[model samples]
Target: MEGKNSQLQQRKDDALPRGTGNLCQWYVDQAENATLRDVEGNSWIDFAGGIAVLNTGHRHPRIVQAITDQLAKFTHTAFQVTPYESYVALAERINKRVPIAGKAKTAFFTTGAEAVENAVKVARAATRRHGIITFGNAFHGRTFMTMAMTGKVAPYKRDFGPMPASVFHARYPNGVTGISTDDALASLHDIFTQDIAPQDVAAIVLEPVQGEGGFHIAPPDFLQRLRALADQHGILLIADEVQSGFARTGKLFAMEHFAVKPDLITMAKSLAGGMPLSAVSGRAEIMDAPGPGGLGGTYAGNPLSIAAAHAVLDVIDEEQLCERALQLGAQLTELLHSARTTYAAITDVRALGSMVAVEFADAQTATQLQQQAMQRGLLLLTCGPQGNVIRFLYPLTIPDAQFRQALDILGSLLNQPRS
Candidate 1:
């Protein structure tokens, strides 16, 4: 008989579409905290954290209990069709935490893409403008408007166009590529002079830390300038914290690190501790720009997700995951920095709290490191347009001993002779 792993792989090949990229070959049998077990009985340490969706760890009891409790009562009522208190309660919870000033409101959606799209929709309605701005190498989402807003070309926006109009891109400062903040700001000015004028712009959307753009941390002055420019012109500033929010950055929200505030914020991924939930919380006036029956989905803020989100917030407070993220990030950043001496190929290691990444010389070097990391039983993921950056999104709930073990394994791979 064929081995169970092989059998499952064959079935997966026959059943699923190739478009749904499977990074790991084996299916997970069970997971708890940072440990994952495959159906074939092999154990692996999780470092990807389900693409930054499990900051509280996989299957936290609080979340499970909350989800279970809500399941027994009811699953979906389509909040717009028959509103629920859980949705309002969760919004209130987020309202108190968002970095926005003054009164704020929140709207829920099912995925990060929906939150992004809705944010832009509200921005357009509020500003009554057709133009939006984004940054090169930044990732918003995969939907039509977001895809247009995204700056990457291949894989994400390759034949999907003709993309939506009035979505412009400014250069995001990347030290690795020698782009300075001055260069980035100059590019924005160029966009105004060369493309859409600033008056026609509705909002400028960016990831506080560019998640899919290789874990680039936005500089404080960059954000401040954006805020000032948004005020100078009549535009909204949107912080896409979908992958970097909810204590991932050693803070409740990564934008909290910056001195400036965004008019709107879109969050998801870890917002519900792995539950499928996304939300847009912003200024009350802007969030209310869309008229009644304008901004909701059939399963938006499903009761189960709302309940799980409430438990997630409670767990974040009880477990102090924000402090844990800082502790973990310091350790990982130090290891990555030290490993640079062992491996000359590593160009840089950077982190903002637990959102850490190490960049290699090229895509092949990074890909080799990823495969070798797996051989050592540590799951890793690559990011960036060149795919030369290895991002570490290990759950903050990972045990110290286990996390150190994973780090050592990675150091061994990085120390290997250049491929």
Candidate 2:
């Protein structure tokens, strides 16, 4: 009686956990650079980019070829056992590319969350301290430790209590939310004063651009100040570039925009062109703090994913995706501002390269806008504590004509009043 997707949705509701949030009702049968098609042959412009995980687009030819070649060679030997060259090569490439200073080293992992957890392990081992300081509104990961590090509670941290201890949270500086750099610094100072002393802290972790925290861009000075603080107290600084890496923010890494460099950088999301791979690149000696057999996973740096990552790197450079991100960012920002003239409820439009988000006056309007867009074959995603922000994560490889079409749909939606 109904469409295939509608039937599947019913099954999904019956089988899948309620905890698993499904933003799109239709199940995607296929995806291209910046669009998705359902099993029923309905097409939708993909603005979510698989939750900022497809900057290189869905199955780039280069990535596909790389994976194919690797598949012919061998699938898994486990890096710790019969190690492969591709894994080593990928690590070398990441070490060179990341913004860490002085003989950086890299270790691979299977997911962004693993990279983060390992980064903390390396920090704690290097500093010989167990205390970690994160920020409010930050979304590090979903694991027990990361859940503790994460600031939001409702969806991610709800009923997942008894999180790891000694993980403190300070404020993440967001100009849109009125949390100034000074205010954030004050919060950090308070953490040092009230919770854990600076000397006992292992690392201060933060996102270059808060991805799920409403796409808030951290102030330039805020990171620089954290660098200084870390140095003063002998604490490592870790930039969680999981969502903002691989040219998502114009630079190869978002930290490059800042004057200072973090001690370690965690990269995932678009690292392997849709393949599952993540890495932690950092100072050599610090990275070496973990003893033999101290870190690693069987699936970490699978040859296929490593090969795909190499291809993703090549695609970014050759395709000039960094520059493309900048160009797309300009267009998106301009469109949002223009729409703001018509819809004052569109309070803010934040952009850092192609990573853009439009914040509405309230959560209801934002959710309604996302539904409105989806009904017109444009997929959208909302984030923020109150769910009042719609983040744009279209692929950098999106065709120009398609990009404009998605923009037009958004512009039209902005003109409509909340009924």
Candidate 3:
């Protein structure tokens, strides 16, 4: 059966289009902590951390055990039909820890896109507005509405045709490319003046630290200003922490770095310690705006995922992985900085906790670096609008020895002359 499955995957690839974007040449046979063994029996350190979904590392013992225990009792009981304590308990825990000031509530979903969609529903329902403002280079999701909200076009939005209306894009504050907080605010003002009135907007959804948009960190001032603008215009402020949540940015949520409070926050990625779960937590008044029947899904808060989420939360708190993120981030930034001196093609080195990134001269160079690293048994991911950025998302629970080994491999790869 295993051989048949492998053959099926090989055949499937031949039938699949190149547009789908293939990462590795072989299948992942097993993974533990921050290491993955390919079908060929070669192991590679997982610096990508499953795109920030393995904060507790792959197959974390607690999460695995929790899922196993839940399987013994029951697996699915659709919360809306036969409510479960795990779902309610997980939601309550998230509500209490979401970094909000006032009363907060949480709703669960299966993916980050669903959480974002629900957040939009809550905002539009509460404000009775039609328009939403997202930033340039933003990546919300692949769903029809989120695709409309996303600012980038190329592979994600091309040919999708006539996206949802009333969604506008403003410049995000990026110091490297010269976009400033003032510039971002100016764009927002322009949107109100030219695109839609402030009162007509339902929400301004943003990433505290953008994921697919080259790992740009939204300046504290910019976030504070946006918060004030939302308050002034009665627009809901939604922080999409799908990638930056669960200690990815050395905080429970990236918004904790700033004083601003968002009316809604969408989180997924590492929320379940590698299980499939996403959530929307926000001001109770705003979240409750949707009718009781207007929210939820059959597989939204699956029992197994909920159990894993509870274990993930407990592991994070008990292990103090947040502090570990800071320590690891600093170490990685320092190492990358040293390597930059030797690699002229390497330009920028920036990090927020373990969410670090390095930009090359161009996409071709980034691709070459990634290929070369993979040859040497290291795995990495490329980001940025131009695909010139290499983002590191190593799990916080990765042992120092393995983490350092991955860094050594990366350092050697960076020192090699670019083609």
Candidate 4:
């Protein structure tokens, strides 16, 4: 007799492509803040937070009600066609909130990739240049243009022939990997000298704190220098906040931690509290460079997602999630540091608020820890070029008791001998 999970796994294997990988084999039945229940009634602590898409947590009440209310009125009128008030209103809110100099404007999209690709378009239009520069290990998106911008090669760019041209990668400062800030700046200069001249580059895009490539925080000085370089070369600076936005990093956006401002910012994932909504917010002048009809999609600003995003903003403010993220992050960081004494394989532990990650000596050790944690009903996600980094994306809204319990599970697992 096959169990429910086994039966569903078999069906999934038959129906889904091999490329659509799943971290957990069990099918989810229901989910709440920081927890997921499988079809077999087994519950797991959700540390992955749906790949940083659930910063407000699963099915937040306010977000749910907002989506439901919008569903009552209408679903999609297509902003490019009918143009709803909610769409403009959401854009206005994001424009007001995003970190950009002078006046800012925001345009909505359905995915982070769409926002990123459109940002590139805006940059090119504004600067009248074609080339884009991104840092190594950054994960922009899977779309053709974004794939070209993305730093990682393996599975993301694998088997996909001929990425769009005019995109280049620079070395991102990673202390663990022994790449210093000077090395990164030198690499960028080398790119300008060897591949594309600074005048030909339209934008330099990067994650304030990298997500998929590894949880490496871009140093403050590095960002400042990049800002200076962009100004000197007339290149636009873009911060991809897809995985670091919505109070996950103790700030609404990771760029807030830096003193220098970017010309544009790309955001998604937690913007709608689990609903699919992405936006590109930037300087009003730069954004307006793209003439009418140059940007937009059939489902650009879905009404339900707009409503949920509005609710998400309210929830973040009312709940004081930013401060809570700092508190929880400090706790988790302390716990990981304590575990370091016992676990020799623990290499590095770095964090910016709750966006935390632990690196192991090898990919096998990281995988072993993730599997052992999963067996104990705790979900974890791994990243990095070597697949040796375990990132913690737990919701800031998680209850204290549940968060502590998850930490306990991790501590116990760390105490056990390596598999």
Which candidate tops TM-score? 4
Query: Across residues 1-419, which tens digit of lDDT does each residue of candidate 1 receive?
Result: 78788898889889988777788888899999899999988988999999999999999999999999999999988998889898998899899989999999999999999999999999999999989999999988888988998889878899775998899999998999999889999998999999989999999999989998999998888888888988999989999999999899999999999888899999999999888999999999999999998899998998998999999899999999999999999988888887777788899887999999999999999998898888788999999889999999998989889998998898777666553
Candidate number with the higher TM-score (1 or 4): 4
Clashing pairs in 3: none
lDDT tens string, model 2, 193-312? 999988899999999899889899988888888889889999999999999999999999999998899999999989998889999999999999999989899999888899999999
Which residue pairs of candidate 4 clash?
none
Model 4 misplacement above 4 A: 416-419
Model 1 is weakest, by summed lDDT over 10 consecutive residues, at 410-419
Best by lDDT: 4
Better of 1 and 3 by lDDT: 1
* Candidate 4 per-residue C-alpha lDDT over 301-379 given as tens digits, one digit per residue, 9 for 90 to 100: 8999999999999999999999999999999999899888889899999999999999999999999889999999999
Superposed by TM-score, candidate 1 places the C-alpha of residue 303 at a distance from the truth, in angstroms, of: 0.6
Clashing pairs in 1: none
Whole-model lDDT, model 4: 0.94
Decoy 4 TM-score against native: 0.99
Per-residue C-alpha lDDT of model 3 across residues 164-265, encoded as one tens digit per residue: 999999999997799999999999999999989999999999998889999999988898888888899899999999999999888989889889889899
